[model samples]
Target: MNIGIIGAGAIAHFLLEKINRHRHENLRISSVFVRNKEKYRLLESAYGVSLYTDLEKFLDSDIDLVVETANIDAVKTLLPSVLKKKDAVLISVGALADEALLTEISDLAHAYKHNVHLPSGAIGGLDLLQNAHALGTVTSVSLTTRKPARSLIEEDIDEAKTVFEGTAMEAIRQFPKNMNVSIVLSLAGIGIEKTSVRLVADPHIDKNMHHVEVIGDFGEATFSITNNPLPENPKTSYLAAMSILGTLERIGQKIRIGG
Candidate 1:
């Protein structure tokens, strides 16, 4: 599968290295789209892919899939155009918290016969949550995320503190970069407004911790995951980048583990 990446950040760099190491998978990065050509000029020779500043030229490349490792602004601006040409893998799942933008992308994907894949970022038990929701038995879903103070805020704190508590939609609006897992959980089990979220900044822990609880007619399930932040980026979890690679591998699989 030929892939086009939309950013040149830490996740994009990690993905390029992994894909280069696993060239036998037949996954080739055909091109990259970025705003500043000079800033990412080194990636061209390192990854052996063309970089285009123009959206039209980038979309016109020989790419069957587009992986957006960019931020919410890129998703809001560039993703619709990408879906019109090829399928997309969105890493910024928090952007979908906007109901209007979500509907717009959904309509565009439907109109173009394209798939918008959202990777389960930084957490697990999504398959169970989805299955429970499929049976229409899921009553409530809640997520509590705890991260190091540096990841959550610029100020150094001596003690752990609860930063924010609200619905998934509100959480996303407040902490756009850190609350993507809450949005992903909300999408898998319930609507954003119906899903509750809590964010905490802890000085005691160095890892990013997520606690998910789901209740339903079937039973109650609670999941706790502690993830190390990416080496280059503190706001992103290493597991989240691995999940993107997993999602990409699943694309060409003959039999998918989870539908």
Candidate 2:
């Protein structure tokens, strides 16, 4: 599997290190695309992969899969074309909040015979949500995300404050980078308008915490995860990067597990 990565940020760096640790002879990084050529020049020598600052050139490379660890804008602009030629693993799941864009990607993938894989970022139990939805019983879905006040509102507060309470779509608009989990939950359990989301600014906690709940005729499900943020980027969960790596590792495997 020849892979192309489309970011040079914290998640991209961490993901690369994990890929190196679990080095697969078949899984190889063929190219990297970053906006800043000088900033990520080290990647060329470190991974022995071709690096390109140009999007067109990067897309022209011999990459079987393009891993989007970049921003939502990058996903919106770059991914549709990539899907025409190869499969993709999208970490910027929040971008799919746009119904038109999501439909466009789905159409392109179906037409191109390519797959777009979405991993459980920062939290889990999404398979349960999808399963419950499959039974036509998933009636309710909600995500309560608690983060350090400093990371949320950019200040330490006296107590935990409910900063935002709205639909998953609004929450994503409000906190584009911080609320990927809300979109992920929405996509799996219900549509965006029906899914509830709450963002908390908590002075009491140091970690990024997510509480997801689902209700249906199949029954109820609850899950909570306190994720440590990546060292280079406090807004991102370390587990999120690991989830992408795990999804990549699962590729080209003979044995399949879980939902």
Candidate 3:
């Protein structure tokens, strides 16, 4: 597998390390997209892969599978044509909040015989949720994210306050970089509007916590996840990077359990 990565951010860096650990002899990250030339050099040295600042150059390479970490803008640019040639695995799941865009991509993938892969980034239970949705009506889905007040909001001279409390649609509209889990839940169980979302900044909590509750014909399902934050980027969780690794392995396997 000649893999290509679209960003050199924390998740990308961490995933590359794990991929090396997995050590599929033929599977190598052939190319990476980075904006800065210095960053290209730095990442090239670290990962032993060729780096590109240009999107077209990276896309034209021998990459068979591409993992996009650069978010919506990158998805809009890269996915359109990539779906024409090969499949793309997306980390920026929040981009699908736009119904038109999601439909467009979905249509393209179906037409091209390729696919868009969505991983359980920070939280889990998506398999159970989706399957349950088939068996029973998922009447309501709600997500509550609690974290250190400082971690939830911006830093550097900002007063403390709980910023976001609204629907999943609104959260996706407001926070593109964060709130991917909300978008994922919305897609899996229900539409974005009906899926309830709450964002909190509690000064007391030591770790970033995510709580999910689903009410349906079958009954209720509740889950809580305490995620360790990534060292380089506090906004992303360490579990998220691990999830990506697990997802990658699942895709290549013969019989993926509960995919």
> What TM-score would every model get versus the actual structure?
0.96, 0.95, 0.91
TM-score order, best first, reads 1, 2, 3
TM-score top scorer: 1
RMSD of 1: 1.3
lDDT per residue for candidate 1 within 180-227, as digits (tens), equals 999989999878999999999999998999999999987999999999
Q: Candidate 1: where are CA atoms >4 Å away?
A: 21-24, 154-156
Query: Of the pair 1 and 2, which is ahead by TM-score?
Result: 1
Cα lDDT tens digits, model 3, 1-259, are: 7788888888888877776545665567778887786845867767778888777778788888888888788777678877887778888888888888899998999998997888888898888789879965889999998777776565533333567888899998987767898998888998899999888777777677899999888788999999988887777788888777677777777886884
lDDT (CA) per prediction: 0.91, 0.88, 0.81
Overall local distance difference test of candidate 3: 0.81
In candidate 2, stretches whose alpha carbon ends up further than 4 angstroms from where it belongs are none
> By the TM-score metric, which is better: model 2 or model 3?
2
Per-residue lDDT of model 2, residues 1-259, tens digit only:
8889999888887867766545766677778998888888988878777889887788789988999999999999999988988899999999999999999999999999999999899999988899989967788999899988888787657989999999999999989988998888888878889999999999988998899889999889999999988887876788998898888888877897876
